[model samples]
Target: MFRHKGKGRRYSHNLKLASILSGVAGLVNITGVLSVNSLTTNVTGHFAFFSEQLFLKNYEMALIYLLYILFFLSGAFISGLIIEWTTKYKPHSSYIIPLSIEIIIILFVGFSPDLIPGISQMIISSALLFAMGLQNALVTRVSQSVVRTTHLTGLFTDLGIELSLLFFHHQKARRKQINKSIFLKLMIILCFFLGGILGAFTYQHFQLKTLLIPVGLLLFALWYDRLLIRYYHIKRKLR
Candidate 1:
């Protein structure tokens, strides 16, 4: 799925990529809130909480919230750096490296509770935010900004604009473009909702162990991408 770019990238590829990643993201976001008492998927809500805490003179929590935002940014920065470093020798590795890093981080996070106590929600929140940040960055790069799995604000905005074009646009080609965008965006949104349902249910029963669910999904993406690429190379050699 990460192998193509621009016009070479297909709607089918984007749909699969968005659905799986968005579903995993939804699981992480809700599960993080349930486990850590903070949202891990996006910084917008944290920024609001930071402002509120600042106004109330709760300086300690305000700083923690500020760290939440920074950690998320740092994760993106780190992933971007890895991409740049890998692209020097293997262009495709840009996506692979960041993705592999994200998977490792998620693994650590999933099992961190084994040694790390549950008393520090802030620490756990930052870890999950970093993982999310890495994922959001990786998806943004691979999709060339066509999709973002972690947040729905911009997706909904684009959906609204596309819906407008689909209904009222005069140009046939423009309408076709709008139609494709709407379908892919809708699939991502619905898949995310489905992920949340799964996360909530798992959390209710298994508690923090629910973190393992997303790890399994992410590993699937990693394995699938790598194996598919390898298969293509072998097929090309035979030709």
Candidate 2:
């Protein structure tokens, strides 16, 4: 999934990509909410809060919400910048730096040292949002905008549109493609829900440490892809 891009990418690649990353996003989403009483995976709600605070003349609180949006945007900017710069020399591994950064952020927050309660919560929420921004950017670039794992708003909207199209578009080939797209969206939604469920259950016992589960999934994806590459190389040599 990380190795393919542009036209070289296939539906199966996106299927695998969406499946894993969406689940990770879901896990992070719930963990952030439970840990900080805030949403960390997306900034839509933050925008609303920012507006409300501004209207109430609570400038300090508004600024805090503004900072949350900026941090998430900054994370996305950094992820895209790294991918663009690294791709020139390391096309296949361009995603590693951003993905690694995300992993580090999650791991750090998971075992973060004690601090003032309010300050700690703020830091944790910002860090996870940043990590998620990194992840969302990486996946978007890797899939050429074909897959987005961080938020469901767009997915549900697209799914609804596409589902409607199925009734009007009658060509078999086109319908087949639409069906594939539908299935991909559904899988992402399903995995994200399941991930949230798993995170909620595990958090009761492990709390922040539950993040390690998604971290493990990411590590496995990296290792498994490398193994596949090696096996392909060996098979080509034998052929």
lDDT of 2 at 88: 97
Error of 1 at 35 (Å): 1.0
lDDT for 16 in candidate 1 is 84
Tens digit per residue, CA lDDT, model 2, 1-239: 89877788889999999999999999999999898888988999999999999999999989989989988998899999999999999998898899889999998888874333335677898999999999999999899888999999999999999999998999999999999999999999999999999999999999898899999988888887788779878999999
How well does candidate 1 match the true structure, expressed as C-alpha RMSD?
1.5
What would the per-residue lDDT of candidate 1 be over residues 1-239, giving only the tens digit for each residue? 77676687888888889999999889988888888778889999999999999999999999999999999999899888887787788876578777777777766777777867564777778888998899898888878898899989999999998787766887888888888899999998998899989999999987767878888888888788789889989999999
Candidate that would win on TM-score: 2
Off by over 4 Å in 2: 113-119
State in Å the error of residue 23, model 1.
0.7
Candidate achieving the largest lDDT: 2
Minimum summed lDDT over a 10-residue window in model 2 is located at: 112-121
Model 1: lowest-lDDT 10 consecutive positions: 110-119
> Which residue pairs come into collision in candidate 1?
none
